[model samples]
Structure formats: C-alpha cells, structure tokens
Target: MLLLWILLILYAIFLAPGSGRDEIFHALIRGDFADVEPLVVTIFSFLGVFPLLFAAILLPDRRSGSWPFVLLSMGTGAFSLLPYFYLRGRFKGLEKIVTPVWLMRVASSRSFIGIIVALFILSLLPLTGGISLNAYKDAFMHSSLVSVMTVDFLILVPLSWYAMKRFRGIPSPISFIPIIGPALLLWQQRGEKDNERTE
Candidate 1:
C-alpha cells in the first residue's frame, strides 16, 4: 500500500496529462459546472462520498487509528487513506482504544449509511441525461485534476472492499460494487442486528 501510494503521487505529479488543470480546478471550486463534463462532475462528487464510506468502515474498528486519515481523506481522497491501511497492516496489534459511544453509533448506524446512499444517488443524477465517454476521456487526458481524481476513485474501490472484509469480517459479494456495495453490506449488517435483537 505504501508503494502504491508513492507510485500514485509520482504519477500524479510527473506523468498525469493535463494542461488546463488550474482552470478546471478553479471552475470546480467556483461551482462552475457549465463547461465541465457531467461525468467529471459526477466522479468529483463521488470522491467526497468515498471518504464518508471509509470513515464508516474504519472508525468503528477502533484499533485502526484511522480517524486522522479518514478526516484528511475528505480532501485528499486515497492519498490520505492508503497510508492508514499501510500502517494498519504493519501494526496489526495496536492497542484498541475507546472511541466515543456516540461517534461509533453514528458511524455504524443505518441512518449514516442512508445518507451515504442518498449522496451517491444525488451525485449520479448529473449523468442521467447521458454522457459522452469520449468527451470525458478527452477532458481526463487534458486535465490533471480529472485524471488524478479518476485514479483516486479507482484506488478507493478495492480499498473499500478490503476494509469491509478486514474490519467487518465477511467479504460480502456486494462490496465489490463500489459505493453501493459497501452501503449495502452495512445495511445488511444493521438488519441482521435488528433481527438478532428481535429474536
């Protein structure tokens, strides 16, 4: 994971293509999506959702010491998270600490998962009218922000799956489906807990 993070940083700095990166970045910052491709906008929005999902998975584990990385990931995406996973692997026996009961409840609650699903659906709405893959590709090739963000999203997919498996204990097949998969896995767990309580 450390090596992958290093390679990603090197690629983003030295190899990713895009000359109008500054302009695209400014436009996104200013909420100027009129000229940006819907696909790009959608991907950018999902970048935000990805961090929340990770927080849900990692915070409840308590032993991962993942809070700092999870917070940083809100802005840096996988750049912040890969390190947490790397450290977690290296220090598997880190003493478990007591996370706040409320924080843990919020992170593990169905309500929080519902918010994630809603945000993901809202982000996808931009692409409802159809998008041009070629146009998105052109933008990606010409915009460093877009290209790096795309790579970040790709990296998060497997990390999310692995985090779910490692922390949650079972690799739900649905987790391989990206945001929706993890959300579903959490939702299923919540449902199982409810059933257990009822019984």
Candidate 2:
C-alpha cells in the first residue's frame, strides 16, 4: 500500500501547475482533443499498474462465500485491496493458503456487495464514448481549481484514511500519510477476527 500511494502521489505531484502533463490536459479540455491524443496515451500507465496491484492483493484469500463480488470490485476498482492484503500477509504466514470456500464467502461479503452495486451504477455513465464523453470532456475543460482538488482529495484521502482504516489498519500519522493505511487496517481487522473466533 505504501508503494501504491508513493506512485500515485508522485503522479499527482507531477500534475501540479507548470507540469507538462497538467498543461496538456488543460489543453485537451479546451477543445484540443487532437493534441491530447499522444498524451492521453499515457493513461495506459495507470491501467498497467492497476491490474498488477489488483491481482497481487486479490488472488489470495480464504474468506468463505460470495467471493466473486470481491473479484468484480478488484477488477473494476483495483486499489481497494491495498490495505488488507499487505497486513494479512504479514501476520498470517503467506504460505498458509486461504481456502477456496473462504475466498467465495469474502467475495460475497456485505461490504463487497455495496461496492458491486456502485460499480454497476458507474458503468452506466456515458463517459466512455458518445454524449457522456462530451460531458466529461467539458468538465475537465471548464472545471475550477477547487473542483480538481476535490477530485484528487476524493481519490487520495479515502483510500489512505477511511478505507485503509476500515479494511486494512491505520495506526498513526506516519503510516496514514505514507498510504500504508491499508496495512494498518488489515492489522486491526485480523485482530478483530481473531477475537471473534476466540469468543
């Protein structure tokens, strides 16, 4: 998770003012899609890391029942597992091997269920191509400085703070700032699970 945040934060920093890519996107939003093509190609960078990060964290697990939704969430929103996987791997011996039954169950978890619903709703948005595409194109072009920051905050904060805390285990400002929130959240969740088992 730290690694994930480092890369994302680095990318975000580069997007600050005077950055080439920032200027380029600015141009694209201003009805300069033709010029943005070469730059838009850079989106593949995010796409590449997306799948690897998702698979690394998602491929291993042992929670029982309804696991497919977990997988659906990973494939659609790969970063979700960053916290949980790192923490769990640390305490539980990586080679212990999560059972198939458990994996299915986690995939079907209530939390995961809600994510699936959101993903499906987002899929219906017209951003990919056609009229909706124009809407996104317009927003990026006309959006205010505050709007962009809001987007960045939404992406960076939840994953680093709340999601990390709820799903992974965030303990302090250091780890939280570093995007190790996932690892922190995982530690807490595992402890809770253990306590439940004991009870």
Candidate 3:
C-alpha cells in the first residue's frame, strides 16, 4: 500500500502538473469530466472499494480506539494500517471484535471478490483505444476517485493473496491467477471440502 502511495506521488510529480498533462490532471481533480474520454472517469468514480476499506477499518471500533485509524487511513492508506501493528500487544480485545465467522465469510464471498476484480478490470478498460496512455496516466495521477480506486485495488490484490496463504494454505500458484484466486480462497474458507481433500 505504501508502494501504491509512492507510485501515486511519482505520478503527480511527473504527470499531473505543468503543461503537457497538467491541464487534464486539473480537470480530473476538480471532477470536471467533460473532456475525459469514455468510461474512465465514470466507472472509477463509482467503485465501492472505499466503503469496503472503511468497513474493515471500523471493525475494531472504539473499544480499541481504532476509528481514528480509519480517518487516518482515508488520508494515508497503509500508514493508517499502522494502528493494527502498533496495538498488537497493547490489546487483544480486537480479536473478539474480529472473530465473527460471518464477517470473514462476507469478506471472502464471491460477490465481494467479483466486485473487486471487476473494479480492477474496469479501471483498465481504457487500454483498448478508449484513451491514450498519457490520458489514462494523467487521470490516475490527478483524479481523486481514480487514485483512490487504484490504491485500494493494489492493496486488495496483495491482501487477498496474504489471506489465502495464511488462512487457507492453498498451493502458492493458485493465488497468482486473477479471478479464480479470490474465488478459491473464499471457497476454502467457506467449507471443509478443500480440507477433506487435502487430508
């Protein structure tokens, strides 16, 4: 997630200001999409990744004083995740907050995974002649919605892999596949079928 933020910063420095792409960047930042091409702005603006992220952040709630971290996350991405690492020994109460089977189930659900994968794919749809590479670059570089979506997607990609490895213990290669990865991870989480086969 820090890498995502770093890349976003680099994009802002190189692609979001002064001549060339600067004007486009400004328009996108201001939500002035009248000049942006195709569904690039439209689709990215509506993806629900932020809400998903917020829900996860809020899971620990005031009991652990984790809500402020969610606000911090809104501004700093993975830096906001620091509270979790920082409070590791400070509190174990969060375990009760996070131990619900149903919540994990929801996170691992096919629909949730599909929405995430679809958001990533839709974010890339401009690659097919919808806009110039530079145009896409500037939009991502400056558009608030686009930057947020990209960061969340980047975070989710690695996070999903980590969850699968740590919890599901599936073969390494399975997590490398796109849509199938999240599906299989959640499926294993959902029942004993995979565990039975493995045993």
Question: Which candidate tops lDDT?
Answer: 1
lDDT of 2 by residue, 22-117 (tens): 654465448555443332322312222323222222443443111342355333333434434445536554345444755435532434434433
Better of 2 and 3 by TM-score: 3
Task: Report the C-alpha lDDT of model 3 over 1-199, residue by residue, as the tens digit.
Answer: 4464566566544544234444544666786766775455544442334334333323323343444444565455544554454554577775444434555445444466566556656655554555565765666665654555455546545554553464455546666554345454544454464467688
Off by over 4 Å in 2: 1-39, 54-61, 64-67, 73-75, 78-157, 160-163, 170-199
- lDDT-wise, the better of 1 and 3 is 1
lDDT of 1 by residue, 1-199 (tens): 9999999999899999887436778888999987788999999999999999987887876556787788899999999999878887577554454456677778888899999999999999889878999988998888899989999999999989999999888687778787988988888888898899999
Over 4 Å off, model 1: 92-98
Q: What local distance difference test score does each model get?
A: 0.86, 0.39, 0.50
Which structure among the candidates has the greatest TM-score? 1
TM-score of each model, in listed order: 0.92, 0.28, 0.47
TM-score of 1: 0.92
Q: Which of the predicted structures, 1 or 3, would earn the higher TM-score when compared with the native? A: 1
